[model samples]
Target: MTLSELIAQFRTLAFDKVEPYLFDDDSVIGWLNEAVKEACIRGQLLHECDDVDICQIAIKAGQVKYPTHPQLYEITHASLELTSINGGKRTPVCLVSFEEMDKADRDWRDDQDKHRLDPYFLIQHDTYVRLSRPTDEIGVLHLEVYRLPHKMSNDDDVPEIHLAHHEHLIDWALHKAFGVPDSEVFDLNKSEMAEQRFTNYFGFRPDSDLRRITRHDVPHTVKPFWV
Candidate 1:
């Protein structure tokens, strides 16, 4: 099954679990499906051939720790709890890309901020999307990263989601290996910190102008990324 289809089915089960919280079942389902689809696409294989289950393998193999999408929910929950956090001020959802880092970048890497090197822990299955507000003056954009488990052995289940397209397993290796945003870091000692951090983390560099600058204005009912 495609990611979207898989998630539609899972929504029923998830809704029952979170019925007391009044969480919007549809939105959660959409977000999860998107994560899975992205994961499969990055793997460059059909969902069935190389789905997110590889993420479980990564954990079992001691590659990384957690799924970025679900971890995002944790981040969102924390953001929501703070009265200081506002819609525009607080970072919106993060967009994850399911691509592995290049080895050339890895061999040449040399930076003091090894914490940013966390991308080595993540596989391509995990990424995130972040929304920016007018006041923040940043454009809405997706933040694709490698995700890893925080505390799990090599035998954990992979995070999965079914969208309309197919069922995809999360790339926990990429999720754990994600690069933190310059905004996320409290220090600003150098202008190259973010760039350096991404290199160390993902062993790749994104465009500097590519700062969080895209918006997910469309409804989840429509697949915007595909369009």
Candidate 2:
């Protein structure tokens, strides 16, 4: 839903549509943005909510530096392919860790010929990829990265989450909005209910399965404690 729609819905749910809105537009928008971030973090592990982008890194001969996206939160995979010298076919290059890359640099300094073929990389400063050996031939590096959710500023901007999960955002926004002291709508029960609903619907814990057991599932002797 649009930000305007979300605000309207939140107002309706909070009963704040008298004359002067208990929560202003900026406050609601801020709450909604917070809600989006919360939902994004909560659902980050779910593949259904992930967005895939194919980024191309241009390789220049004797250049080992390449910049990464500012919004990049995590890199799932990185693949490097070298273009054949004679325009034949692209060959895949092996990816190595920081330690391996450092070792490769040391080995190359000692004996360049032996380690020239081994191209390794490590993320530098969490912002750029540093390759161990300078590229002998031009190639492209493909990176599959997961980025943080985009914050909504305009009314028409849509959230990155699935439409089915949008209501959770509203619940979170309402929870936050009602918690504000100036709003004059301080209901701990409502706030807690919204939070619990969001967690029950989207939050997944390691012990969720064990926690799902009902009282009826317990033995007669253990029922009293569970109840």
Shift of residue 132 alpha carbon in model 1, Å: 38
**Local distance difference test scores for all models:** 0.29, 0.64
TM-score of each: 0.19, 0.64
Q: Which stretches of candidate 1 lie over 4 Å from their true place?
A: 1-22, 46-227
Q: RMSD of each candidate?
A: 23.3, 10.9
Local accuracy of candidate 2 as per-residue lDDT tens digits, 1-227: 88888888889999988868878899889888878776665556323213333256777777777877666544555666665432524343444445444554656433434234444553433577666566677777666654567789998987777888876788888788767665468888888888888778768433433322320122335435553
TM-score of 1: 0.19
> What is the C-alpha lDDT profile of model 1 across 1-227, one tens digit per residue?
43333334444432323445332434444344344434433332232212233212211221122334443211111111112235334333322222212232443223323223122221222243221111112222223223322321122223442232232222221122122243432233332442353234324323323322211122335546753
